[model samples]
Target: MKTFGGPVLFLDRSDINTDEIIPAKYLTEITKEDLKPYILEDLKLSGFDPKDDKTKNARVILSRANFGCGSSREHAPWVFEVNGITAVIAESFARIFRQNMFNCGMAAIELPKADLDLIFSHSGQSDAAISINIEAQTLTMSGGGNQKTFPFELSPFDKALILAGGWVDYADQKY
Candidate 1:
């Protein structure tokens, strides 16, 4: 897949678990897209509207450590995918959550501690823009006259799943 760029939705907070991604109450929804409305239900209580254009239009998610620590709910990444998040760049992600992202055809890039710190420092800025180069395995963060490119790690096998449009698509081709 070619690289894509978009405004960054920087969630400065950390330790965001699966429940925060999609509340358990909405997990029973027939489809993952149905859970999009509650992508960050907990944020609403903090005066953040999940339906706001900023959130809805964000294609890149920048968060701190332990991004998805709680449940292994696949719906978490599904919520992100349906909401237009093709890439998630964080300092760290729970093991299962990272896999879930790949299963959903979303890039879950784990940035080095130093690189993550740089990104976080620019959070909340009006011009925070980040581009993800799927093929090149690079993340370009630019805004406010600043730009930097950082390399992320992703196994070739897992990358294949994402480029092929998730596991099902890959399996279809091989089988």
Candidate 2:
């Protein structure tokens, strides 16, 4: 299974779309690796630079609701996978986007608004990071001398997809 969690990149906005995750112009690239370096290149958030070290090093993304909005494309998740981002934690996700994440063996974790508020409080701190334990079904956020844990659930099929390392691998084993 893909490892999840590490330094968190907090995107303090909602409705972040696929085009922002990866500009559509690069879609014709030959490989997922070719799509790297362009992830989030078009995202226009105050104080967020796509080229920043924070972007390059983040292994998990924390964002507000409606992440992965806009077009339904597998390339968005491919970009994140190439970037070594194993998970995205948000208030909610676009349905297709959430499925696509699991299809790629990545976590699309949803937390209630109150829980998100608590987690967002720890964001932007230099030491902010998260630890995800899928088997335990819990997310632990720590930074600024504070820590919090929250529980989340996944459907049996979704859990199986993640554990088996995505749909293709799951099929390879099951069928």
**Model 2 TM-score?**
0.96
Candidate 2 per-residue lDDT over residues 56-167, each given as its tens digit: 8999999999999988889999999999898999999999999999998899999899998888887769889998989888999989888888999878888888998899
Q: How do the residues 39-152 of candidate 1 rate in per-residue lDDT, one tens digit apiece? A: 877753342567787787888888888988899888888888778787888888999998888876778888887898898788757788899888888989998899999988
Q: Candidate 1 — worst ten consecutive residues by lDDT sum?
A: 42-51
Cα shift from native, residue 80, model 1 (Å): 0.9
Which candidate number would show the highest lDDT if scored against the true structure? 2
Error of 2 at 55 (Å): 0.6
lDDT at position 92, candidate 2: 93
User: lDDT scores for all predictions?
Assistant: 0.82, 0.90
Q: Poorest 10 consecutive residues of model 2 by lDDT?
A: 118-127
Candidate 1, position 98, lDDT: 89
Candidate 1 local lDDT, residue 69: 86
